[model samples]
Target: MPAYQLYVYEDQEKREALEQKICEQVDACTEVNGKIRNRVKKFLIEEGITDISEMNAALRVRYEGYLERNETVHVPITCLRGFDRIFLHRMKEELKTLAGQRKYTTEYRDQWLCLTHYPDVEVAESFLTSKDGKELVWNFTLECPRKLKMQIFTVLKEVIHTYEGWTRKEKLLALQRLYQFCVVNQVSDIETMTLEEEQKFALKLSEDLGEKKKNAVFGILRMSRKILFLQAPEINWNANVWFLERFHFSKERINPSKPVELVSFKEVTNLENQKILQKYLRYLFGITDLCISTIRIKLLELRTFLVYFNGEEKPIYEVEAEKIQRYLESIQRQDTREKTANGRIFMILQFYNFLVVKRYLKKIPFRYEYYLQKEVHVHNDRSVPEGVYTEILSKLAEFPEHLRLMFLHLWCTGIRGSEVCTLTGDGYEEKDGDYWLKVYQVKMKTYKRIPIPEALYKLVQVYKKKYQIGPEEYLFQNQTGGAFRYGTFRYQMLKYCEKYQIANGEYIFKSHDYRHNLATLYYDSGISLQAVRDYLGHEYEEMTRQYVDYMPKKLEKASEAYFQEETHSFAAELMKGEFHG
Candidate 1:
């Protein structure tokens, strides 16, 4: 009823002699006759008679019905060698063809038989074989062990064959099938098989010759299957094998000729030794896409290097520098935009030095020294009057209740519009008689607690009551009852400003501009630069100083007088001129 099973048996010398006789007859046949020759051969071999001429006499004396039924025919080893060699040789050829076609490579040898490529041995006395194989070898006085089942050695072999020359994804699937077979079959002691056994197994499965002549064949098959199944497509199986062979299998010689190359941003792109140039454009000037129109020339130069040096062994740093200089010279000859070119070159030089310090490159190229320049900080020229805030607040009153509160929150706390949109009930906290919202600034990588003004707090209460605020709800939920994204919030703010005609129609401001406005206001209110910096959570005082220049002249004068102990009238005079209260 089952698809297949295994059988073990114990056979003494008599049974062994009979099986050997049958094997000899099979081996001697050059071409098989009809059933008569088969019957005669079986009888002579099983009865242990040496000659077919003596078969009748020996069978009649020993047992009856020897010729009556085919199963009754049994031969002995002594009689097998004496059988016609032509008939025996044919039988052997037939058996070998059958085994090969069925993917069975095992062969019988004398009384003791060795399975092809399989580690297990079947002796004359205690022979363990699969059920089907046993059926073919029955009538030899051998018995099957009830519990033993057929072991499909062919499954592993076939898997190994299938994985060869397969693509990464295909190899992975093949390995999965192999593992499933092992788990399902409960195969154990795979390592016990000798090199002969493994080779035999491989020969049985497929005709292709594997690289490893002996024992390593099995290991290589297993490893390759696993790699194909478990690792990503980008991961190189051959490279991994080479690494393992070099390190783990020290004695084994594996030399891979064409190794994969690792490319960098610049190497892939082909910019000259302009490390500083690239860095400045990318980081300082905020030009993110070097391959775009902004830096097309540099990108083209990098592309040329990649093509010219294709498959060549060259240090990436050197290649990058050479390509960058070529581009620079080309731009100079053409009388292109000198300012932009110089800026790029300078940044590249700085970036080169940085890479050297990080040990990514060995040496800073000589051209870097010529391009190095000290960085300068420029002041913004935008200025706003004190009345501008009041005017914006009045325009915000014309919008919906929630919009009004959102504007007030942004203006009062100096938080970004996106942060305001993302605010939820959980962000609000009360501590030491002060209420504040915890702002998660992604770029800053820290949470900021911005104090809520009284006016804004009252407005929030009104907004919450109107919306029937829930505990886990966003404070500024959109139509989907979820927090608004940055783009949506910005759009809404711009729309409101347009509709209200606020700040002389110059009410356009980014979410970040609020922080700048707050910093300026804080400095004008006579707060110490350090105090303002702490409140804003700025790492450097220089960043906070950007707002200092924007402070009202009156406040600036007051600060100067306070520090220098000059005339107090200086503050009054400066305020009269600068303040439009």
Candidate 2:
């Protein structure tokens, strides 16, 4: 390391002369500027820093140290600022004359230095300026072998190019920790890292980092092994998960509440089983009309079933009806819900059907209906309680403007939460005096237009105008300018409801509940069942009936209307007997 020059003067006469010069510089400034300078001068004289050195950089550093150690240091920040303005700036020319024209010295940072040791010079140069590289601490990778360093850099390059925000930062941190572990263990090849070494690294991380941080690091590493090392034959970390975005699902226009991101087959450790599952997924995603979300659920259910039979020596093709019965019994022993259990069995049956079509299996293993539990479709009261919604409306001003408007959409229209999230600016239309809002129902896979409150329509127009939203843009959007996530909306609404103590802090906000509320309200207002069904975007009136709650009032109203009529046979006889018999 090159030593920085210290210009501390030992002679008193030279120190006094330099102090006088600094004082003279202060005197030339106005009173406001001179106040802080005067403090710096007084501080220097008190410290007996009558040392003048050609290296002003070194001199300033020494002065800073004195300021820190001194107990009675007054306005140190101001004094430091004054030191730079007067000593460094005003006296720069004089100092340069004393030590020739070398005003600033170069100090090589470890980050820049590590580049020389990197295997690929051009890659290092490009990476040095990349987003991930700019923030990396080079000390962790300094002693790692060329191949290991190259692997780390490659992963980082992919991470920088692929991800963004805190996700990118987190993956970078995960890689850095991995690099440090590699360097310490003298492991040169990350691709050939052993399972034992992987376990050791995880244990070390858990000890050094807390449980949460360690888990996060391991999660990122697992994801990187799947994503960044796609062509690599093997990696130490066992991650049989794959991100769905790589398959171009975006083109399909399927954006679900919980994004269909990764599918994990880690439970099914058999490589042949994994390949079979992958082929099934590819078939579902490509050939079938099934929604991506539906496909994801099927994949999860299949993974569980495969995990159950993982210990078996036989391949999935050779599984007989007897084994299938055992698997069914094992699942039945668990405390799974009837509906969920039935769904799981149904998915397995579907998978078997797919296998038969592809010639992987000679025939289906067992009768699907025999294993399935009878599922009763009992509808729960999902409507938001009157007290809860009324309370929300009472203090609606307290919530954000956007949220308040979104609530109105749910309150006024019996639309789904997903439809509310994906409302576009041009979805609103005015015909003569009536206002109508058009929304695409993701579930029904169609657009539905219904009359909306004039006030609500105008409010939306005003909001769009205020936000400068274009016709093609979503009425409500996330930070990324895409349609706002329904999950995020629900989460934020619940947070605020709890904060403001809505329903005495006991009520959890559910967006779907508002849909039910609107449906019930429409039914109670004497709207035809067919009209309510249409408004709710339901395929059948029977399905819409499930959404209608508070049915007792509607039933009571119907009974009262029936007896009031005198012309009806039973009602007329009762009226005649009471009045003239």
Clashes in predicted model 1: 46
User: Which candidate tops TM-score?
Assistant: 2
Q: For model 2, which pairs clash?
A: 9-51, 15-50
Candidate 1 local lDDT, 46-104, one digit each (tens): 66665432322123323334332435345432122222233233333443565433432
Q: Can you give the TM-score per candidate against the true fold?
A: 0.39, 0.66
C-alpha RMSD (angstroms) for model 2: 12.8
Please give the distance, in angstroms, between residue 101's alpha carbon in candidate 1 and its true position after superposition.
Answer: 35
lDDT of 2 at 312: 75
Give stretches of model 2 more than 4 Å off: 1-113, 116-151, 159-173, 179-201, 222-239, 250-253, 330-339, 552-581
